[model samples]
Target: MSLLRIVFKSLRQHLLSTCITAFSIALAAGLLMSVWVVREQSRRSFTQMDSGFDAVVGIRSSQLQLVMNAIFHLENSPGNIEVEDYEKIKAEPGVALAVPIALGDNFKGYRIVGTIPEMFTHNEYAPGKKYKTAEGRLFDPELREAVVGSFVAQKLNLKVGDEFEPYHGLDFDEDHAHDETYVIVGVLEPSNTPADRLIWIPVEGLQFMSGHREESHEELSAVLVKFRSPLAGKTLQMKYNQPDGHLTMAWPIGAIVAQLFDKISWFDRILEMLAYLVAVVATGSILASIYNSMNERRREIAIMRALGARRSTIFSSVVLESASIAAIGVVVGFSIYLLITTTAAQFIRAQTGMVIDPMEFHNVMLFGPIGIVLAAALAGVIPAMKAYNTDVAQNLVPVS
Candidate 1:
């Protein structure tokens, strides 16, 4: 028989152990690739996150929270800044454009943000990419029409002609639905940004909503600002970042996100280390599994030699079995990766407003699984050599 046939026979004889060995390797490989994917994909998403905004102007509070809540929609607002404060930021020197957003309501759990048509008119939400109306025109600020994000439309089954009343705050409760209903005038193409989950109406419309009051009246959650030139960012930071300043600016979304990831980088490293440890355990499992079966197979090896099979043939069969397990395990591991990433992709997008493509091929493909196979092959060395050295004279007499 060929080496593969012999290998298959041996593996079939030990089905349970073979499955356990393959699955352990698969788990280790999946864990390794998963960690690599999260690290790389998140890094890429962070870099491309938001562009064209020089600064995020908001009430004095946690700068990280301000940026995350205002741009990414990942956190709650620290506080609101009045419309006057928003306009003041817009009027600041070197400020070329400022889009105001007022948040305090939700439409079935999706946030209802009040912003001017400039949100659709500006390319700053993403660098050089303007928001395109997928179905209808941008909502007129004079009316109570709304524009929904792609995800919002998909999740809520909303269309341009649909009209819905928003609830108070972020909870998806019907009891808090306000008296006023807003018509959906437009649907935005997927921008892969937080705005995709928002129900954007006129800033004036939000101010007139039920939660509005003098304290939060005409107040904005944040002013997304763009400078006439790159130099304006330095001026905005130097001037407004003060302990007594009513508002602060967080500029160049890239830096803010970098800082955020840097803080959690250690956690990623720990995961990577754990992945390696799993791999080590998987290798040991393969080694122990093959080693323990060696004694039982010694007589078979002796009989193979008695039947004129070469020592090298027995060795090759053992090695092939180990390598086969590794190969199958890697494929299983990749399948597991696909299942998880595909399942979580939409969820991650909805929660963090960052797009994660599970199938976006990465460099990890070249190395992670290949390393597992090599480790598995190495794990078979002792077993393969032991099988090759079987003594036909000593073992053939004992079988009876």
Candidate 2:
């Protein structure tokens, strides 16, 4: 028989053992693939979110909270600061631009952000390096018209000419509804930042709707400040706070990314530990299954040896058979993992407002298949050794 035929025959004789080995390898590989897909997509989403602005200035509070609230629209704002304070910073010597933000409402858990048209330009978050409306026209400088984010429009099935009543606060209760209504004059294209999930309106309109005018409103949510030069950030930060000021400023990109990683670090570590544990257990199971099958195959190995097959040939054949089973298992496991990831993508996106593409592959996936094959080869070593050292002469002699 040819070498390939010999391998197939050996596997067919121990079909149960081969199946068990393949299943274990497949399971380990699937788990590894799922983890890699989730991690990589999350990183991509975060990187896109981080590219919008330089610094976020808000009420004196935790720098991380300001970033989470302003950049991601993930958490509630840290109270509010005076609009006049923001105006002062906007006119500062090194300040290139300052976009005031007024946030206090939500439509189905997504934030409504009130800011100037200049915000889209200053932050470079606009489409095609310039702000352009995907539907209808940009918000008129007046307070009654609003522009909806792409996700908000799609999710709510909203379009131009739709009228939406603003709520008094983030609460969705009917009682908190504001007296004035907003006309959706425009819809923004997907920018893949907080902009994609927010409802944007003129800052003056928010103040007018909220009934704050003349005197400085004590509650301005946050401000996006751009410096003339990168080095201007440190200087502006010091002057803005000034030890007694009611506002604090931080680099939004750095703060948001840092806090996100910090928050997920423990979870990532747990996942890593679980992955390693699964891999080790899978390896052990594959080893045990192949080793146990050796005794049942002893007569077969002896017969082959009696036919003038070299000891080395018998050892190589056994190891090669186990490796092939492991390889097949890895492929099957990866398919199962893809199915699970694709099914969960929509649910994850709805909960986190973060898009995940599960079909994307990363280099980390290679480890899973490689690990399975190595483990299978290592497991066959002991059984192969036993088969190689078999006493051919004694077996052929038979009892009397």
Candidate 3:
């Protein structure tokens, strides 16, 4: 039989051993792939959703919370500020535009925003594009008309001309539903941001529904401001830090990204450490298996040598067997990785409303398999050398 055929036969006979090695390698590859997928998707999603506003101006709160509430619309605002204060900031020298946000109430945990059409117009998300309505039209000047985001529309099965009563508080059933119903005049095209998860109405409408009239000091959740120049962020922050200032100004993009990674640093580190540990264990297992199997194959190696198989051929065959097993492990591991990531996508979206694309391939994923293959080859070196040095003469001698 050819050396390749002999190798195949041997592997088949040692099926358990081969399978164990492959499984070990697969686990390592799968974990690494999963990590790459999550990291890449998060970076892409955050970048895409956080383009327009340079800073978020809000009542004194955690910097991260301010970004979460203002840019992501994920958390509640710390407190409310007067609309007049927002107008003053809008007129500041380096300010390009200031968009006011009024938030209170929810439809099944998703925030409802009250703002002007400028909130959509001035947004920088999905650059070079504006918030387009997928159906119907934007909110009209008339009170009680609103626009629903695509996610909201799909989840609630709402369309243009449909009317729904807004609740007064966060809970779906606890708070009293607004006595007044709001007509869904429009449904916004999906921007894949918090915008897609919110119901938007005219600021005046929200104020009226909440009982805040123009004559009184009406409070706003936050203000999103774009800068005329990049340097304006630092200058504005300094100016807003005066003791008399009741609000805080922050660079949304920088602050949000930094604080996000910072909070998750421990989790990231744990994953990375586990990945390394898995890799080491996989290599050790493969190496130990090959080293142990060398003793049982010694007589077989001697028989092959006697049959005219060269030392180089014996060595190459052993190395090839290791390489084949490693390759299979990598393929199996990637399959498992794909399965896990795809399965969790929906659950992740439901819980966090963050979309995760599993099939997206990155260059980093290639390294896991390559490393496994190299480790497997190295693992076979000792066994391959022992096979090369097998004593054919001694093996051929009969016992006295």
Candidate 4:
């Protein structure tokens, strides 16, 4: 029989061990691939998150928390600031434009932002890029209309002309559903930012929904501020962030997010180490599976030697057998990796409303699987050497 046929026969004889070892390697590969993809996608998401606004103005609160909640529309707003106070900042020396932000409601966990049509026009997602709709136009500030983000529209399955009532605050309070429903007049184009997860209406809509009495202080959760220059922004941030200032200024959300990531980088490092440790255990499993089978395979090796097989042939066949298992392990590992990542992408979109493209190819995955293959080849070394040293005369004698 050819070397390939012999290898297949030996593997078939220990099918359970072969499957177990390959499965262990596959599980390790899947986990490692998942961590790599998440890391890359998260880095991309953070790097591109800035919408070119220079600063955020909100009621005196944690600057980091304010920016995260306001600009990202992430969570837990830092209360509200008087619109009159915001206007005061808008009229400040270097202020270019101030877009009002009011958030007091949600629909199924997606934040409902109350801002003007100008937000899409004046705001820059990048240096020269502005927000635009994928299909319908921007909602008119004069109408009782809503504009949902691309991810929001898809998750809620909303379309232009659809109408829905928002619940009070971040919670889904049936008792606090707004008296009036808002029609979906438009859907913003996907810019791959947290903005893609919001539902927007005119600032007046939120004020009206809250039933504030006439002449009451019109309050906003925050304001998006752009400056004429970076120096102007720094000066304004210093002025507003002063202890005497009722409102705080948070500049350049990109920087705040960077600090946040830096603080948590150690946790990410821990996860990475754990993933590699699992891979090491997978390699050990390969070693044990092949090594344990050596005794059972020795008699077979002796018979082949009697059939004129050289020690080199026995060694090569044994190595090829183990290497084949390792190769199969790599294929199975990648298959599992693909399956898990695709499912995770869908789950993340459904739960967190974050769009992650698992289909996007990441470079690390290229060299990673090859490393697993090489580790498997190395795992077979000891057993292959033992097979090479088998005694032909001693093992050819039948046991009593």
Scored by lDDT, the top model is: 1
Superposed by TM-score, candidate 4 places the C-alpha of residue 351 at a distance from the truth, in angstroms, of 4.7
| Residues 1-400, model 1: lDDT tens digits | 6778888999999999999999999898888888888777877786567645767889888778888887877788888888888778788889989988888899988999888888778655665788778999899999999999998999999998999988888777887788898999999988887778888899988888875676666678998888888788888887889889888888777888888888999999998999999998998898889989999998889988999999888888888888888888889999877876766676678786678787888878768888888888888888999988888888888545
CA lDDT of each candidate?
Answer: 0.84, 0.75, 0.78, 0.81
| 355-381 per-residue lDDT for model 2 (tens digits) | 777777677678768877888788777
Model 2 root-mean-square deviation: 3.2
Query: Which ranges of candidate 4 are over 4 A from the true structure?
Result: 1-6, 212-217, 398-400
Estimate TM-scores for all models. 0.93, 0.87, 0.88, 0.90
lDDT of 1: 0.84
TM-score of 3: 0.88
Q: Alpha-carbon error at 259 in model 4, in Å?
A: 2.1
Ranking by TM-score: 1, 4, 3, 2
Q: lDDT of candidate 2?
A: 0.75
Clashing pairs in 2: none
RMSD per candidate (Å) reads 2.1, 3.2, 3.0, 2.7
| Candidate 4 residue-wise lDDT, 12-62, digit = tens | 998999898878888887778878887668756664565667788898998
Q: Could you tell me the lDDT of residue 63 within candidate 1? A: 75
Q: Which stretches of candidate 3 lie over 4 Å from their true place?
A: 1-6, 171-176, 210-217, 343-355, 393-398
Q: Relative to the unseen true structure, what is the Cα RMSD of model 1?
A: 2.1
